[model samples]
Target: AQRHSGAAMAEQGRQRMADDRCNAGGTAEHARPGDPLRQHREEEVGRERGLHGALRLRRRVALLGHLGLQHVLRPPAAPLLGQGPAGARAEVPPHAGRAAGNYPMATMVYFQCVFAAITLILLAGSLLGRMNIRAWMIFVPLWLTFSYTIGAFSLWGGGFLFQWGVMDYSGGYVIHLSSGIAGFTAAYWVGPRSTKDRERFPPNNVLLMLAGAGILWMGWAGFNGGDPYAANLDSSIAVLNTNICAATSLLVWTSLDVIFFKKPSVIGAVQGMITGLVCITPGAGLVQGWAAIVMGILSGSIPWFTMMVVHKRSKLLQRVDDTLGVFHTHAVAGFLGGVTTGLFAEPTLCSMFVPVTNSRGAFYGGSGGMQLLKQVVGALFIVGWNVVVTSIICLV
Candidate 1:
């Protein structure tokens, strides 16, 4: 009887694993119903990742409130809850409901939904205070359908870029670059905020903004770390690289502010932190700690120059009220990250993952040049697609 029961349990474990309902604690051997210790450990691992996601969601709330008080109060259902979630499924595995990687099918579905939600929220910041809520409500689904889905598929969902070996470790391109470009483009057609309002878009709540910024800084553990979809070495390195880049970027950005602006601005620090996070994301797990710091230094200074220097001179940028400077932070930082990944991605690290090819960074020379070219082409594809598609969506 005990033998039969053990066999049954093993069968159950195989079934669970086959469905991708994997636990963090162990493998098939730990699937016994009586293994409370392993089960507890599994729960702990899951709780950690879940909290990371929850923390991000909380931080996002703070950002929305800071970036757009009106949008914060408005409902997020603008995209039709049902519509977006369904599309997320398609983005992952169109042919099957099986688990895609280390996590469960349900978990994959959930995260995809969250990614979509966050992307929409990030894009909306550009149009805040100027566009009507009703128009936003209508715009969400249209943009998701026309702009986001295609981008997601082309990058993460095993489209040409994925096959061509463009590494995005996370959504530096698919989410940030695409949304930033789309947001800026849409903001163009939507028109700028009133001159008086544009001249002074004061924060509604500074304390909450700081609180949100702190949470956002912390939440990046999951933001970049969670891309590996595992609690292994890759995710650990990703978390480490993420923090290293962010801290370096923050300090650099703050120093630039002090040197040029005559004061260290809290907003400037937060912007720097975000750019660092975005900048390291594309190669978080694939690069060394030192590379992350190099990336951070560049991420901090480059975006600041563009937002502070270039924005003032660019007639097109000034004409379009990118209310939150999405172009500078997300689009520019994200594209920089992708290209940097091609320049820094380690071949040995890339060897661990079956999906990643062209792992050698340009810094290593040889085929690395090809990888960098691929990254540029991939980023350009996303930028072009968003600009064209977003304009069409906004026009309609």
Candidate 2:
């Protein structure tokens, strides 16, 4: 009886030791192929070590790239105050006001490059799903040099429109209008996507698209806020107006969708958001908050009408096959913004934001009417130039 008892105790001890080993090895007898607890612990360890290391590496690489770009650009020093030829408060030198080793100039250059990049991305909307990669590579440089540079110079670089007091606070005409017209023209030349794509070019991932759109929306704060070239009251107003207009336009658009289509669409709301942002851009700092809401309403409704109603009716619009409706969202909204800027730009705000002295909207009752005329003329010039240049580029 004592020997049997001792044998039982030995067997029990062996079984407990085996169980301990299995647990420590993370391969318990009952463990499945993918043990949840073990897998989770492993993932946590990886995140702590691997993710932190990767993030550090990414930040270092970005910093190195930025330094290289700064070195290559060799931006000039900031202009000195009262250093003009005649001793008047000198115009800020194009590369003026370096806070640290020409950082100001580098920053300005970076901003301009980003603006140009955005323009290219907008133009790409037309060429998506088609266009030879080689041609696109060549086309970018040519378009920037000839088409984009000319617009930038003419409007913002003290060219004809700048001298004439036509205000584009943040590239309503230069970026949005230029890209829209250019995209439409390019689409005509490149031809449509395959019929299958056209018949059903559904977004592969709606959530991802929404995420992209959210980034774009938030980025507009920098887009408009930085135009003042300083962090001032105007910049603050511009950023606020941007959000207000975008939100209002989104709500208006969604409501319209629910009424007409019997359901709200995330895509439609995004489109409305874009239109509102575009519409307010030209006068972001130059218009009052109330004007922004009014502009939002117009932007949301007019673009919606054009995209949904006029697009179907107009043969030219139908033939172009602009995949993303850049024409309606950008061209129409931008034109509307320019016109409204001419009409609603407050005198005080204009004085603060516009380069031209005493600039005021038509509603302010001075040379305001002329401003409107100039705005229209400027739009026509951009449209004609983009159409001609884009066509030439495609043909070449």
Candidate 3:
């Protein structure tokens, strides 16, 4: 019992150290896995102190397309931002920002690849059994090269949108929104599954689906938490918000199912869980816990309305073969999250995680109104880009 007590005390010490590092904002001296400041400054000043730097550098340098020259700048290439002339590596000094080290160069490419693959998988969900394997095989490289890379660059990778101060804390636009829209677009191209199949596409295994959903819910912690690039208070809050929003969404969805259909549904609960996660992701660490609850409640009902009522009412929506309703779940919920983020993002929290100075949600009533506009415009840009790029890929 004494030994266990000592261990617990040690853990508390570590946590307090981490919190210190997080608040003071020092270099990533111990960032082996990119631990944010959690103690006194270490000797080596880490590259990309927080998410701002992480977004501008880590994912930017990492999300190289298969065949795009502009995205990937290899070693001898000139530094992107430095105290030197615009061109030529020899002209730039080594001590300039981002020129000192190849942080996140090869080591971080896998992270971008994983996200890109996730977007692809979500796109596939809408066409699930109907898409041709050969076509899908051909489609993956093209879409990744064209669609995914562009969005990553434009948003998180420090393109025009990032400069415009559009906040997508964890790929609300880049991954979820893009995939949802692309999935719907691709489904349109592929046409609906067989009438008989569409009419009765029962799950082959509910138990397996439940297990998969559970695994996904667990992983979502990393998905939102890792974005802060540290395990500091913001990261902790993000993880907590993820779980809170998901649980609230699941309950709300289940309650709605019971009220409308007179029974609880496992499927509805899963959908609720997903929407909740997607909804909070944009501002998971940026908003307060109370805001997370509000977002979850909206996520639960809005997507439900879109999927249950709107889908049923809209003939055009009916024409599209969105098998798993990825459009409603991801696209709608992602958009909701983005808008809510512009509305609820707290100033202090935003300062910790968001790179932009004086960034706050509309609820704070400063530049938040304009921030909301940016969110809407950002959504429109994503929607338009995916619709065009995915369609071109499908046709080709």
Candidate 4:
């Protein structure tokens, strides 16, 4: 009786094992059709694919900001007025032509947007750590429409200055000069940061600041290069000149810091870099390599003196609290660039890049002296316009 019971128990155990195997095999075979886990995984995969597609679409839209849609959409023509001698229309080269479309109209819209955006960013420098959010929200749109547009039209859009033959290579007047003056004006109205914050303000992250500076430096390739409205030889030369000036400026500034402050501050280096970049922008392509180095050295030293030495001594500068010293970096550097461009702009390069026919620097003789006067006049107009407009905007 005991043996028979044991055999029955063993048979029952085998049957249970067989049932477990069958269930496992059945689940594997039917997983895709009915399993909840498998269905959830498929749904997850679909969501991921959709997310990737959306990211790709967003990337393409961002790229359009750099490559003007008008250029991509329409055929090219003389993109700006006064392209050649005596207002003669210059034919666009194929490569440069390929990048620009719809001539003055579409390209104008795109460039105006670019310049407007940059101006807003520069203006923000003065308002940092202070300024009411609501006021800024209102200020930007109004400033863009009223102030920036006026400058853009007057300078580049065949308005008074365009016809008058005022040359602004990549917005020395429209962007830097305007922003610097406007920023300083606005800061006066907005009031200064709290006393404690002003006295002890320190950068939150040096590494992050450096990273941002690096991006700014690299992006300049497009900043000055795109002003030509095409990918051309002038664009290439502008990019090279931009780097040359920036590097020279950085070295000069670092050297000054080491001599005076006894330490080479990274922040100081970045400031020097910016001043150098701003200094060369007015004639990035219209100046030779040697001219770029000269501009850089002056940009680095002059701004340093104004910011470090003059700022400390001047009561007005001390009282105003021009944060980041936009006045020194943008205003002073920009004006200096304009003056030097007048003095050093290579005649051959000027003819190629500037729309003003027979344009030459002061060094080249002829109407070169007149050109320098025009640069100063252009800067004055910008300064006056910005001061008035910015003050009104802030006051209101």
lDDT of 4: 0.81
| Candidate 1 C-alpha lDDT tens digits along 51-83 | 445544654676677677545456545355465
**What's the TM-score of each model vs. the native?**
0.74, 0.74, 0.74, 0.73
For model 1, what is the error of residue 228's alpha carbon versus the real structure, in angstroms, after optimal superposition? Answer: 1.2
In model 3, the runs with Cα more than 4 Å from the true position are 1-106
- Candidate 2 lowest-lDDT run of ten: 93-102
Every candidate's lDDT: 0.83, 0.84, 0.83, 0.81
Off by over 4 Å in 1: 1-102, 354-358
Error of 3 at 104 (Å): 5.8
Tell me the lDDT of model 1 at 337: 95
Off by over 4 Å in 2: 1-103
Positional deviation of residue 126's Cα in model 4 after best superposition, in angstroms: 0.6
For residues 37-149, write the lDDT of model 3, one tens digit per residue: 32123212222233244344543454453345533466444557763544333332322211223446564677677888899999888888898899999999999988889
lDDT of 3: 0.83
Model 2 steric clash pairs: 78-96, 78-97, 79-96
Please rank every candidate by lDDT, starting with the best.
Answer: 2, 3, 1, 4
Q: What would the per-residue lDDT of candidate 2 be over residues 51-142, giving only the tens digit for each residue?
A: 44554454456565666754333443546663444334333322222122334677889998998999989989977889889999999999
